[model samples]
Target: MRTLVVVRHSKAEQSGTPDFERHLAERGHGDAADAGRWLATQGIGPDAALVSSSVRTVETWTDIAEAAGWDLEADFDRGLYSAGPETALDLVRLTPPETTTLVVVGHNPTMASLAQMLDDGEGDPEVAGRMNEDGFPTSAVAVFAFDGEWADLDMGTATLVAFHVGRG
Candidate 1:
């Protein structure tokens, strides 16, 4: 089975900086680190990662990887910065078939929509409910299990296995 971990970037500064250049806030760092630790405890070691090129998303991924003790490199894509759910899925579909576990760190609305769109309602119902009710806040993560090749993945084809909201 293949695993997909979708993450929304942690809280970011709301200063006058450009959106793409905005950095993470103090809370964002701690929350992202906690998220990494949580993923580690869940035994999720991603073989590949796709992160948005925005500063906040890159920082979030860096913090997560550091806390998880992972040494994998991530593909930072500019397209991911403003990609919608379908566009993000297209990017995911491009992943190499050999990768069994993939992590995607990106902006919200898109990330949240992707998680909801991918759910097949065949896994943990309570987790799915919570994910729907709580909305995709900062540092939110949704894990899905897919039994097909990455290229063949489509809407509602994966099962939501877990959901988490990272806090420090």
Candidate 2:
């Protein structure tokens, strides 16, 4: 089975920061670290990650990697900077079938929407319900499980296995 983890970029300074250069806040840092630990405990160490090229997204992935004790090299894509759910989905499809696990660290509402769109509502009902109701908050993690290769992945073909909101 293949697994996908979608993570929204953490909170960032709202003012005086450019859209592309915004850095995470102190709370964001702590929340990201906690999320990383959560991923480790959940046994979701991704083999590879596709991250946005924005400062905040890269920082978030770095913190997650450090906290999880993972040695992953992220593919920072400029197309993911302000991409939509469809764009993100296309990227997922491009992943090599040999990659059993993948993670995408990006911004919302694209990341959040992609998580919801990919979920077939066939895994944990509670997690799916929470995701539908609360939406994908910053630093949130959405875990999906798929039975086929990445090339065969499509909308509503994967199951939502877990959802986690980073807490500072």
lDDT of 1 at 83: 99
Can you write out model 1's per-residue Cα lDDT over 1-168, one digit (the tens) per residue?
999999999999999999999999999999999999999999999999999999999999999999999999999999999999999999999999999999999998999999999999998889999998999999999999999999999999999999999998
Off by over 4 Å in 2: none
**What alpha-carbon RMSD in Å does predicted model 1 have with respect to the real structure?**
0.5
TM-score per candidate:
0.99, 0.97
Superposed model 1: Cα runs more than 4 Å off: none
Collision pairs in model 1:
none
Measured with C-alpha atoms, the lDDT of residue 47 in candidate 1 is 98
Residue 42, model 1, lDDT: 93
**Candidate 1 positional error at 166, Å:** 0.6
Which stretch of 10 consecutive residues in model 2 shows the poorest summed lDDT? 10-19
- Name the top lDDT candidate: 1
- TM-score leader: 1
Q: 51, model 2: CA deviation in Å? A: 0.2
